[model samples]
Target chain A: MEKSTNIIDCTIRDGGLVNNWDFSVEFVQDLYEGLSAAGVEYMEIGYKNSARLLNATEPNPWRFLDDHFLKEIIPEKKFTKLSALVDIGRVDPNDVLPREESVLDMIRVACYIREVDKGLELVQMFHDLGYETSLNIMALSSVPEHQLIEAFDMVKKSPVDVVYIVDSFGSLDPKDIEHQVNKFKDMLPNKQLGIHTHNNMQLAFANTLTAMRNGVTFLDSSVYGMGRAAGNCNTELLVSYIQKASYEMKPVLGVIEKHMLEMREKWEWGYIIPYMISGVLNEHPRVAMAYRASDERDNFVDFYEKVTSPESTIAPASK
Target chain B: MEKSTNIIDCTIRDGGLVNNWDFSVEFVQDLYEGLSAAGVEYMEIGYKNSARLLNATEPNPWRFLDDHFLKEIIPEKKFTKLSALVDIGRVDPNDVLPREESVLDMIRVACYIREVDKGLELVQMFHDLGYETSLNIMALSSVPEHQLIEAFDMVKKSPVDVVYIVDSFGSLDPKDIEHQVNKFKDMLPNKQLGIHTHNNMQLAFANTLTAMRNGVTFLDSSVYGMGRAAGNCNTELLVSYIQKASYEMKPVLGVIEKHMLEMREKWEWGYIIPYMISGVLNEHPRVAMAYRASDERDNFVDFYEKVTSPESTIAPASK
Candidate 1:
C-alpha cells in the first residue's frame, strides 16, 4: 500500500481558509523541509487563483502564488514535490509556467460536478504544460447520480493524472467512501484515484485508509488537521500508520511542535459542534462557520435546532 | 441497525478516569434527564467498584455507586435504563442488590483476555441477581490469537447477555474492527456483540459504525468525547447518525452546552498528539498521559523519537 500511496500535505492550501493565508515564509519553509524529511510525496503550497480577479490591492503570496516567489521560498526541491490547487475560471492560462521552468511539479484543478468540463480544460492545459495533474471534484456527497454520470463522461477522457473524491462537506463514512471509490474506479479505470477528507465525524483518517486500501493513490492531509471547519486528516497519523520504512513521523512532529501548536490558538479549526451538525446533515460548512464566528457559537442546542428545522434550507442527508 | 441497537453512554464511568470521579450530583442528574429525553437506551452512571476494598474515606458517589445514592440522584426512572461497569475481582458481591430492589438495570463486567473466566463468573452472578450482564474484553488489539481462542472457548459458555470488543488502547481502524467483529461473531455465535472505543487515533466513531454495520448491538460513547486519554466515541455522533426516528439530538446538545463545554475546558480529552502516537504504536497511553502532565507536553518530536526508539518498550502496531 505504501508503494502506491502518496501523501499530499495541504496545510497552507486548505488551512488558509481558517486564517486567510497568514502563514509566515519561515513557517512555510520549515514545513517544506519537514515534510520532505518525513517522506511526504507532495505539498500543496496554496491556490494559484488570479489576484486581479479577486480585486486584491495587497499582496497575498499564498492565495495568488507566483512561480518566481515559490522558488525563492522553497529554493531547492527536496524529496517532496510541490503542487498548487486552482479553481475553474480563477486561473489565467498565461500565468502558468511550464513544469521545467516552475518549482511546482503538479497543478490540481478543483470544481463542482457541474464544472467538470471547465475543470478538465484546465487539466488539459496543465497536462500539456508538462506538469502532473488531478481534477478534484468537490462537494461529492451532494452530487446527483445523473450529474456524476455526465461528469464521468468527460472525466474518463481527460488527460488528468488523478481524479480525486473530495469530501468537501466532511459528511462521508467509510462505507460511503468505499462505494464512491468503487464508482470512481469503474468510471475512470485508466486514471489513478485520490482522496481528500474532512474530520467532522472524525473519519478523515479512517476514510483515507479506506481509499488507500481500495487502491487510491493520493491522500490529502494537514498538520494537526489545520484546514477549514472540522479540518482535514492529520498528516502525522497517516505518516505513522502507513508502515512505509522510508516515512518518518519525527519531522512532521517537529514542524507541528515548532509552529502549529501556537497557530491553533490564534485560528480555530478541527471538530466543533456546528461543523459536526453540518457534516451530519451533509451541508456545506459555511452556515456552521458563520455561526462559529458569532457569539452564539457554543450554544449547540440552538445551532442543532436552527439547522434541522424544516424552514431552514439545509437538506437532509441522503444516506 | 437502530432497531436492535442500544447506546450505552459512559461519560461518567469512563470519563471518571480523567476527572477522578469529581462530578457533581446536579450535573449527573442533568445528564440523566437529558439522555432520557434524547431516547438513549442506557447510561452507565459509573463504577460499581467497592469503596470498602479500595479504602475510600471520601464519598465517591459515581465511582462506588450506592443504589441509595443513585435512587436519590435519578429519583424517578425515565425512558433510559441505568447500567454500572465493574472490573473483575474489584467488585464486592455483597454491595450489589438484586434488580427488583435496585435502581441499576444492568451490570457490565470489564476484564483483560486472561481474566475471561473471572469476568464471566461476575457476569453469571450479576445475571442470577436478576440483572442483565455483559463481559467486556479489554485491549483486543494486542491479545494474541491463541489467547483469544482460549478466552472465546470460555466466553462461549458464559451466561453473559452481551460480549464486547473493547479497544482499550484505541489502536484499531475500521478494517481491524471489521476483522475483529467477524472473529467475535464466529466464535461466540449465540451472543450479542458490543463495541467500546477510545479516540486515541480518532477512529472511535468510525469503528463503532463498522461494528454496527457488522451487527453489533451495544454502542458505548461519551459526551463531547470526554473519557480517559483521547476519550471515547462521542454519544452525539452516534445519536445523530443512527437515524433512529425516536432519537432527538437537541437534548444531547442541550446537556453538552449546559455542562460539557465548561468541563472540557477544565479536563483534557479528545485527539491530543501523545494519545494519537500511543494508538498508532498500539501501546498503552499511560506513558503519554504522564508526559502530558509534565512541562514537556508539547514536545511531540521528542516524544515520537522516544517511543519509536529501539530502547523503548512501545510496540509497533500489528497490521
Candidate 2:
C-alpha cells in the first residue's frame, strides 16, 4: 500500500532559502540525477516566482526558474519528474508556460490561511496550464479550527490535486499530525493529501512518516535536512526508511557525499538549541534564526530568557 | 493524567557510556541538583555494576555507584529519586544494599533475550531487597517475536515493576513503537511499561511520546541526549513537551548549559549519517560507532559501500 506514496525531494528548492537560491549548476544537476537514481518520485528544483513582480534585481535562474535554462541543464528527463514552488503574489500568470512546453511537471503554491483564495487562484492557473498542482497551507499549527474549516471550503472546490499539512514551526508531534491528517481527510475526501514538516523539534521525519501511515501520499523532504533555520526532513532518511523495493539508498548517499556535506558546513541549519525552543513555543523561527546569526549564538540561556519573558514579543524578520 | 507519567533522567548514567563513566564529582552533583529542581521523578546517576566481576582495575565511583559515595554526592535528597542500571552478570548480589539503607530507590537490569532468566534472577533479588526494579530488554528491534513472547512469560511472573521497550539500535519509528507498546500491554497487563529510545533517526523523542500516548509510563531520557552513538532523547524535550505541572524546563536547561553543552564538544553523539544508516538497516550501532572512530570517519560513501556489500559482515565489539 505504501508503494503508491510519492516522495518529493526539495534539496535545491527548500535548501535554496538558506543559500539565497545561489546553488551552483553542478550541484543542482547532480542532485537531479541522484534523486532520479534513488527512485524519488519528484525533485523540486527551485522556486518559479517572478523576480520582476517581487522587485528583485538579481537574475538567479533557480529563484526564477527559466524553462529554457532548465532544459539546457538537463536535456533528457530522468525517472523523477520536476516541480517548483511559488508564493501567492510573487508569480505572474504571464511568466508560466504550458506543461507541454516546459521542463517542470508540477507547480506547488505555498500560502498562509488568509491567502487560501489567492492560492486557489494560482493553483487554477497552473492546472489550466496542464501541470499537476498542490496547495501547501503554511503554518497549519497556528491556524484556528474554524479558520481552517473556512479555508477548506475554497480548497475543496479548487483545482488543486493535493493539500499539504505544513508544520511550519516544526512544533507538531505525531499526535498533532494525526489529528490534522484526520481533519484534512474528513474535509477533502476528493483530493490527495501531502505532508511538509520542519525539523525544529527533531520530529520532521517522524511527523512525515506519521502522516504517510495515516494516508498522506505526498512527502516533502531535503537531502541532509538542508533548509531554513531547523531545516526539513532528510530525504535519505525517507528513502532508506520507506519499505519500497523501488527506493535505493546508495544514490541518496552519493548525492550527500557530492554536495550536501559541504553545503551543511557553508550554511547553518538543522537542530540547534535556539530552533528547538522556538519549535516548542510554536513560534516562527525568525527570532531564533536572528539569535543564531548574532555573536551570542551559543548563549542559549539568554535566548530562552528573552523568548519566555512576559514583556517580550521579539519579532525578527522572516527569511 | 500525564502527571502520573514518570520521567527518568539518565544523563550521568547514559552519557557515562560515551565518556567511560569518567564524569567529575561537580558535574554529577550539579546534575542531581538540577534534575531535583526541575521536578523530575527520577535521576539515574550511574551503573551499579561490580567492577571486580567485570575485571576492571580503575575505581570509577559512577561506574560502580557505591551507596556511600552516592549519599556523599547527594547528601540531602530532593524531589527526584535515584536509580542505577546493571548488566545481568556484572553485579554481585552482596554489592546491592536494601533500598532503605541505600541512596538508590530502583535497580534496573539490562539484558539480551538469551539472558532473560538471569536478568529475572537479578530483578527478584533487587525486589527482595525492597527496591523498585525494571527489566530493560535491550535490542528489542533485533529480537524475534517468539523470543520476546518467551521472555514476557518470565517477565509476567517476575517481581519487575516495569518492562522496558528498548530500541537499542535507534531503529524503530512511531508506528513500530505503537505496535510494540500494544504488544507489551497485551502481554504484561499487570506490569508498567517504559521506553528507551535512541536518536539515530531523530525519532527518539517522538517515539517516546508515541509510547506515552499509548499508555507507556516510564520515559528514559538524557540531558542533551548524551549517550552512546546517536544518543537518547533529550531530557529538556520531554520535560517541556509533557504537560505535567510537576515538570520544570528551566532547571533542565540550566544543567544543559553548565555541563551537557561542553560534554557534547568533547564527545560525539546525536544524528550523524552513519548512525542513521545503521538504524535504517536495523543493525546495532557498534559498526557505525567503529566507523566514526576511524581515520575515514568522513568518508560516508565508503562506509555505505562497505556496510551494504553482500560479502561484508563487519561486526565490531558491542558496548
Lowest-scoring 10 consecutive residues by lDDT in candidate 2 chain A? A310-319
lDDT of 2 by residue, B127-162 (tens): 999999999999998788999989899999998999
TM-score versus the correct structure, for each prediction: 0.97, 0.96
True contacts kept of each: 0.98, 0.74
The whole-model lDDT of each prediction reads: 0.92, 0.90
| Global fold similarity of model 1 (TM-score) | 0.97
Instruction: Summarize candidate 1's per-residue lDDT along B103-162 as a digit string, tens digits.
Output: 999999999988888898899999999999999999889899999999999888888999
TM-score: model 2 vs. ground truth: 0.96
Q: What C-alpha lDDT does candidate 1 achieve relative to the native structure? A: 0.92
Native contact fraction (fnat) of model 2? 0.74
Off by over 4 Å in 2: A315-319, B316-319
Question: How far in Å is the alpha carbon of B174 misplaced in model 2?
Answer: 1.6
Q: Weakest 10 consecutive residues, lDDT, candidate 1 chain B? A: B310-319
Give a tens-digit lDDT track for model 2, residues A143-177.
99999999999998998999999999999998899
lDDT of 1 by residue, A136-182 (tens): 99999988888998899988888899999999999999999999999
